[model samples]
Target chain A: QTVSPKPSRLGLCAACHGETGVAVMPGAPNLAGQRLDYLRAALKHYRDGSRDVPVMRAAIGPLSDAELDAVARWYSVQIPAAAKL
Target chain B: QTVSPKPSRLGLCAACHGETGVAVMPGAPNLAGQRLDYLRAALKHYRDGSRDVPVMRAAIGPLSDAELDAVARWYSVQIPAAAKL
Candidate 1:
């Protein structure tokens, strides 16, 4: 029996949501093309803490359900970034 | 003569992204709290047609230098999502 392939679940989240999430740190808010049901309901509201933070409830509270659906399907595929006036 | 204030730069942006910059639309990346520098550069790219998007060009093209600065600054104030894993 062998199993352990999904360890890199956006761990550090690209060091402040970049490399795909779109953010390059700073205030950090680019979740790269977010969609997939609103990034799985905001990662299930930070793993059910109701979105208050505390490192997003300790990084989504141990994540397991398929690694939080494979890191919200890899930032919901990434593409947005537009519509700013 | 009367002066109009900013005319709501966020505009349709809120239609897709949330009231702030987070995405509520499918495939739309949330911009809640991106860095000022990064957001500015990306917007410049779109305005110049280097990133490839008709809609972005249309939206960002007419913006003057000051407008650009304002929009970027707005998104630069949001907090970031935690490290996902």
Candidate 2:
């Protein structure tokens, strides 16, 4: 699995989720700095239909496991925005 | 905070995500059997605008931290459907 990818290599996920994994769309979740295992599991679920969101499933459809892992790793490593209460 | 709630008490999250946290909606995610820390952190981020998904922000808007914790607990304990590859 590719453990380190440059920000430019984030690819498909960046269309909805921003380059850094914060979402640009209203319904998409921010994935920046999320836990690696959660991102990995979620990506797998999206591919396999366990998560069952049409857009997500479609987005993840053609990706191989290594690609998914690289995408998850890219997002997990980005710095998440701070929470403001 | 209520650590143990019957499925009925999953409440708001269940409206889009099903009673067991498996999403029935096209855009919603399956929260069932997600990690507790991830769920808890996500709930807080939603409330704080860190996650910034409009539907989730609105859904979590009126809830307190303790209430969020309860919701996280509810979903985290649910049985996730197996990933079908």
Best by TM-score: 1
lDDT at residue B70 of model 1 (Cα atoms) = 73
After the best TM-score superposition of candidate 2, give how far the Cα of residue A2 lies from its true spot, in angstroms: 24
Q: For model 1 chain A, give the 10-residue run with minimal summed lDDT.
A: A76-85
**What DockQ do you compute for every candidate structure?**
0.11, 0.06
Candidate 1: give the clashing pairs: A21-A32, A29-B33, A33-B29, A34-B29
* lDDT for each residue of candidate 1 in B1-85, tens digit (9 for 90 to 100): 1222333566755566565666666655566555566678767767766555576677777778787677666655543342111
Q: lDDT by residue for model 2 over B1-85, one digit each (tens)?
A: 2346564346787888777665667656556555576677667766777555689898888777777787777876655432110
iRMSD values, candidates in order: 13.4, 13.2
- Model 1 lDDT tens row, A2-84: 22243376766666776566656565556654556766876676676654456766876777867777766776564434211
